[model samples]
Target: MSATIHRIGGREPSLEPMLSLVAPDLNLVNAVILDRMNSDIPLIPELAGHLIAGGGKRMRPMLTLASARLLEYSGTRHHKLAAAVEFIHTATLLHDDVVDSSDLRRGRRTANIIWGNPASVLVGDFLFSRSFELMVEDGSLKVLKILSGASATIAEGEVNQLTAVRRIDLSEERYLDIIDAKTATLFAAACKIAAVVAERGEREESALDAYGRNLGIAFQLVDDAIDYISTAEAMGKDAGDDFREGKMTLPVILAYARGSEGDRAFWKEAVAGRRVADEDFAEAVRLVQASRAVEDTLARARHYGQRAIDALGGFAPGGAKDAMVEAVEFAVARAY
Candidate 1:
């Protein structure tokens, strides 16, 4: 798919202020990540750099850096910590593509598809080790604890999703549980660790952690909403990739809940048998539309987004904090 920048529903904030807010720290950490990834083994280093330089929103690092500054974290350790979060996030993407057998990511061929699964998997391991190396350099047991726990949660979440695939009995609670572990935990850790580095032991630390957690949940909920409704051209992957994989996401779950007996049976046969046809895709779309899955997902996303904004209760309201709050609204509002 051709690359494009998606302007999620807002009169886009001027990049200048946002960049000023984040640039110094993000540049420093990005440099650190690049320097650390430089290795004697040439191909691995090049491939890893290629993936890193491919334009991501860099939202995780931005969140870490911004959260620290808002709380008056003056230490330079935030840079190292931010880079560590990016490395962990990138490693997960590599592993995720290999697990999903995904062909596209970020408007380009997936690392697994391009480099082959063995190479992708091993390189992902290298990134994980590299992240640990960054954490070790910081010499903080608290930081280590949060990250290690996050990693374990991410692994458990992936296993849960793996088992949930094609299971018609998958509940809303089960789906939310998977997302919180797989997506929200790391995001929570990112903000929480920033607070730890700053030694801000107030209730606000917990609030920022809640902010990240809710933001991640909202983010994933929107992702699942877009999956069924988006075209492959716009989405940068097959529109029905989830369906083809028999992975029951929010839309599927919602549709299943509201489906007629015939629609439910059809979904079971198509998804459980892993025998989806062109007709199955159409049927899936119809069921999801009729059941208001996309609408329901949007409602859920907005609720989480508001929860994220509310978590910022104690922060002095200003451009940076307001932007972050607005970003949540913008992310969820994209459902429209």
Candidate 2:
């Protein structure tokens, strides 16, 4: 890999080079995405579009398309699979905003804020159903099973997060497990299905799945760390939103565990009890930085980032492989 492979976007790098590599297939995926999102109930598309149109890089679907190309796939089923992957992602975002009561997304008003939670939740369900409809149309029982299982796992992850909210003692192992389900499973499935459509054997499938899994873990760790270090505009929401929401991300978990006694008390008072004092968020940021929690969290991300790179060792050296390797850094280096 070239030294340029580690380049960041001066901030958040665009994945356009990677996305561009599979632009033709991506166009087809987009077409399928729009076509599947359509519904007889006019409000369905309208509500779903509210969030879908506000996409932040469309990374999940891009993973599917790029994974297919990396393995030299040329079939149309990956398009349908990519669309299914996108719908699953979109549904989660819609439902997450409702669960989080978040006011912002992708630097825009959240869908739940505009359409209301009931409408957002229902539309999320509709999108999920639409995802499966596309799945069934593809006539791949294996794909159906993988995607359906992923949907269930996403729900379980969300439920776990729900239970953890407002609790300050969440362990690192538990936190990793939660994020693995909530974020990484779909990523693994997205890439794994690429090899499936290509009729590649278990080795290729496992390799791609490992790549996507590690990348997803690295991606979420960066997102968690950046919530403390980035601007609302940069993060598409307020910095420290996770703290405000009482999310025990790795940064918080580290700060709490490794912190001084005063630090532990401050964290418990601020996050554990759901305190909303005017200065509470500032104090939380201060503690997170003082502990170097974000930095340590990112160190953890870099580990997974390397693992993601290693998982691609079986692929032939080329533009697609190079882009995939760079993308692992894109998952973490931007936070610097």
Candidate 3:
């Protein structure tokens, strides 16, 4: 399908439909989250809540809810599972902020910055434990296997990314692999578990997995592009953060390959942590734009977004399917 389909009638795609569809379930999920994050150690909930209550779309859990809705599921089993997914995601964010030494997230001080890295890491571990508890409570060995395996894969991906940091030679293929493990795995699991709860066959499970995995990839790609093109206010974090941190995201990868010799040299220096001034970031943006790196990065996102939409082809048409499709459109349209 054409990327232009996301922009039909010159209207912007919004998450409103999906959010509206899942709001009731999401409220229950939030209740589970609140009840689980509590501990006698006040610091546990305090730190966890800092990030959890902070601005976030709760996209992963909402996918689980929406996928259940698409399957016409009536039971409440997915509620705890959706909350589990959010806990896992939130745990990752806490750990990620510490790893990146990020001070700002969602336009506020990151957990690590406020409570320190040790506290943040420990609280992340606490949330992970809570997620596993929810999974075990649901009494599904299959669900346990999927979520636990995803947690391990996310750690592996983090290590891979850590090793690849500051290496301008990082291949596009390797980068995609890293993101698939780190970000897409959970998305796939979240959706796939909905099928499991609905007791659907393998074909339906695989389809939801494909839809979610592709959407996750598209979501991360848009985020990669936004780092260079958007403002801190707009992005909820400082723009050019990836450049300053020397993270080898897709835009930098493409720009370096397509840039002139001088441009490549500049990128090397920037990625090596020598050129981090605002002027250097401006030049990096110029190079990326000149080489159409950001543009093409967004194009790649649209490709995966289309794949996500196509994966839903077998599902019956309804508000659920339309919301899911528009969710993909919203994911790919953010960069525009």
Over 243-311, each residue of candidate 3 has an lDDT whose tens digit, in order, gives: 999999999999999988999999999999999999999999999999999999998899899999999
Order of the predicted models by TM-score, top scorer first = 3, 2, 1
Task: Compute each candidate's TM-score over C-alphas.
Answer: 0.93, 0.95, 0.98
Candidate 1's C-alpha runs over 4 A off are 1-18
Tell me the RMSD of model 1 versus the true structure.
4.4
Shift of residue 254 alpha carbon in model 1, Å? 1.1
Model number with the top TM-score: 3
Q: What is the C-alpha RMSD of each candidate to the true structure, in Å?
A: 4.4, 2.6, 1.1
> Which 10 successive residues of model 2 have the least lDDT summed?
1-10
Please say which candidate is ahead in TM-score: 2 or 3. 3
| lDDT digits (tens) for residues 99-186 of candidate 2 | 9989999899998999899999999998899899989998988889988999999999999999988788788999999999999999
Better of 1 and 3 by TM-score: 3
lDDT of each: 0.83, 0.86, 0.94
Clashing pairs in 1: none
Clashes of 3: 0
